[model samples]
Target: MDKIKVIITDLDGTLLNKEHQISDYSKKIFKELYDRNYLIIVATGRHHLDAMPLVAGFDFPIYLVTSNGARIHNPNKELLFSFDIESDAIKSVLDLEIDPEFTTVLFKEDVWQTNKTNEKLNKFQKELNYRPEVVNFKNETDLKAIKMFFTHESHGKLIELRDKILVNHDHLFSHAFSLPYCLEFMDKSVDKSVAISKILEIENVRFDNAVSFGDGYNDEKMLTATAHGYIMGNAPESLKKKLPQLQIIDTNEFDGVAKFLAASFLDADVLKN
Candidate 1:
């Protein structure tokens, strides 16, 4: 235990339960830590606008690492830092001759836009509680996109597309899968760990004094970057295999994050029920 000073976590499948919301139990633990002066940060692949609403009820100042580490926002949604994908890169992606089966969404500072809509897109929108504006990219100019997301029903197909993109523009972009069906792209230097490192530097905290929890491939770098990283037991076995050194804890559905924090920092067993 290096005296944890900061807590970094993913939103979707780590801190959030099956309903895509933080449990009351987790909320209480988070508030307790916030009151004690521990920095609480949410590092996610989600856009800041979408991510902020989920944690809106928390009264304390929480930081956000959004757009898969491309942007960092303060509690008030002010842009503290950002890295945008070049217009050329966005153009290259848009110019690609891809299958109509996959739907692509482009994320700007204020809104996400997509020309095509499908069942998968609708389902994703429902999860976020926000809908993207339908727009044709050809008419859009000076597009400073923070991220690009591609979704399909087949994981194998998504991997193939990811490989194709890498082969063509590996130097211009970095890629990760937030979900099996979702392929996300950002600047070459972006990753959750990058954001975490920046936050540590800003707070004057040692790397060893940070703890992170996550359950997706996108979280791999963040987990490895910290001394105390825990993967939820509900995570896919493949992700678990990749980080065998980190501890395994109960699933998000079981309030694994809350239980671990309570036991480790609060010195009390919240799971004694």
Candidate 2:
């Protein structure tokens, strides 16, 4: 009900449609809001190298919270803030013994690394693209892991692995399913809401006055941090069931976020028949 001071959204399932690109309408809406002096920030479970290019066309100041808030970069691409797993914790996760069905992915320093090439990866494009660095994890050491990941098809199986890993290591790291096929591990303190609040504080804005949108378990804190939070219709059933109180927007494929923004701030009845 308070005048919205900032617009923050998650990438993949919230802003980007099924084709993994921001719709023209979405871009236009954000541009209009930008012209009105609203700060637009994108918070994603993606690495900066993987997330930054998608919003490069914004042509305005936009902050990026990457690796599920393990790191943040300003519009100028400067490292605004960062949090990494301690060396010991990184070692423990690296030594994790588990099913080979899951592929490993991680971000270290300025690079995105993987044990092998997996075609299912959304960012794996054949054109001039940001490719993952393929290196056998066995040969890598002393890695200051910003975030580590495992991708597979079975959400239930991933939960099993997640719980098993957390049995002893939960204190060292936090885990979340960015996508049904992807489970991510970051430093225990890493959170998108925390990172967003830091940005808001620097911008001298109120947390309760922020407007946020997201569609995953990783986004729970982010959605709860603001008085206005929306969940995408395409979110996992479990996520919806977990937070049924959050308003449900249309599917991303239909530009749900854009429509909501237009209706809310622009005084447009996009969702009205």
Candidate 3:
């Protein structure tokens, strides 16, 4: 066989439609791409459980890099690689002055915690498909943390909280917003690029042969690191500015990722361009 070509993509606002559902066009394109022996890896800031359903019905050899690279797994649920976050580091982060009602979801063994109200968090847990244990901090036992998430509403307020945390945790951690109302935390070295490089190494594909797409600040690193990157139109201005040279494709609302792949590899008949 020749070299393996790979395309890594982010989920929301990059692969999924406005309704958070994968479109038929995308599904067909993915089928074609998988049939052609191209590797499709989903690199997202979502937890594994959340990402699993993103490609639920697709029968293809797909890989996943989740939690901003804190964990990597194959489509078959085989653990390829992972990085653990120190419990002490997590405790220090939780010590910040941020609101406790927002709660924190840790990926270490799939642990979740909150001291404030449970109404909002219970709804969140249902969306994520996990019934997190409710603890009062005094009864909590396991502290081993892999990833941390904070759910909030205001982007400006989240950024402010992020900045305050950064002051004390600078260079000690990495952060990303999986959603406008979410803040994802990982170790400093954990990011899509690091995970992509590792995947490339494992698959023996050169970095130059990889193509990636994303639409958020967490995606900026992978988009910048890859030889060719397609930024979704909905990407934040700060993220777009990070790669001033790359081309910006249509918004995820238009199936930007599937459209790009069809144009680049699939036969011309598959795309209207």
Candidate 4:
């Protein structure tokens, strides 16, 4: 019930519905929050280029913390902050034997590159889009990788890989499960909470004045850093069980974030659809 000066949320499973699209009801709720002068921030493991389109139509400023906190962009889409995995670290991972079945995607400044194409990923996106350039990492020399995404059908396999990487290469990068099928890797120092804190500082705000929502292992820090944080009902059981202290809200399929905003901040009820 504390006053909230900023609202931060993850993309794939928090603000976005099950289909990875924003619902009209949520749009209405966000618009009202903007009208009421509530600050908004979108924190995701997505690249800045990929995230830009999803939040663009808001018609209000929404700061972005992308690449699992490796990059930050202002509402105007100006690059405010950025960090990259050291090229040596990039080469080290690229050298490690990864499962051939995994689809590997790389991110840099305005560059989204992948080793292969997987149409199956479309189901998890707002668009059935193949937006990354297919490339062979072995031949690349000059590269700035902010984050690496590895996807597989088995979330459990990805979890195994995450553990393996952390155990063998813990000093090289941080790892997380951004989605059931997606494993994310970034510089060891990258963190969504740290990124959000930077934004809060720029705005002259404090953690206690912000509320955040997320549904991934990558979100743990940001959720704990904020004064109020909630996890979606649809979030993986592991995450829910791991962070029982945070409240669990309705699933994204049911407009969970919007419903919460309506109850906590708006006068009108969000009638169930």
Candidate maximizing lDDT: 4
TM-scores of the candidates are 0.92, 0.93, 0.88, 0.93
What does candidate 3 score on TM?
Answer: 0.88
Q: Model 2, range 35-142, lDDT digits (tens) per residue?
A: 888889899998777777788767677999988998889878899998887767766776876666778877776666787778778453323345578887677766
For candidate 1, write residues 1-273 as lDDT tens digits. 648888988987788888777888888889988988888989999888777777775667898998899989877678888999888788887788777678888888777888786665554333454557788778888767889989888989999999988888999888888877789999999998988788788888966888999988899988888878999888878889988999999998988998898888885554453
Off by over 4 Å in 3: 1-4, 101-103, 114-128, 137-139
Model 4: per-residue lDDT, tens digit, 1-273?
A: 556889999988888886677888888889888888899999998877777778876768889999899999998888899998877777777687887788988886765778887777645556423266788888888656888889999988887877867776798788888888888888888999989999999999998999999999999999999999999998999999999999999998888988998889877554443
Residue 254 of model 3, lDDT score: 91
Pairwise lDDT winner, candidates 1 and 4: 4
Query: Which ten-residue region of model 3 has the weakest summed lDDT?
Result: 117-126
lDDT of 4 at 191: 91
Model 2 superposed RMSD (Cα): 2.1
Give the alpha carbon lDDT tens digit for every residue of 65-119 in model 3: 9888988997678988888788777777766645764655666556455555446
Question: Looking at candidate 4, what is the lDDT of residue 206?
Answer: 91
Model 2 poorest ten-residue lDDT run: 122-131
User: For each candidate, what is the lDDT?
Assistant: 0.83, 0.83, 0.78, 0.84
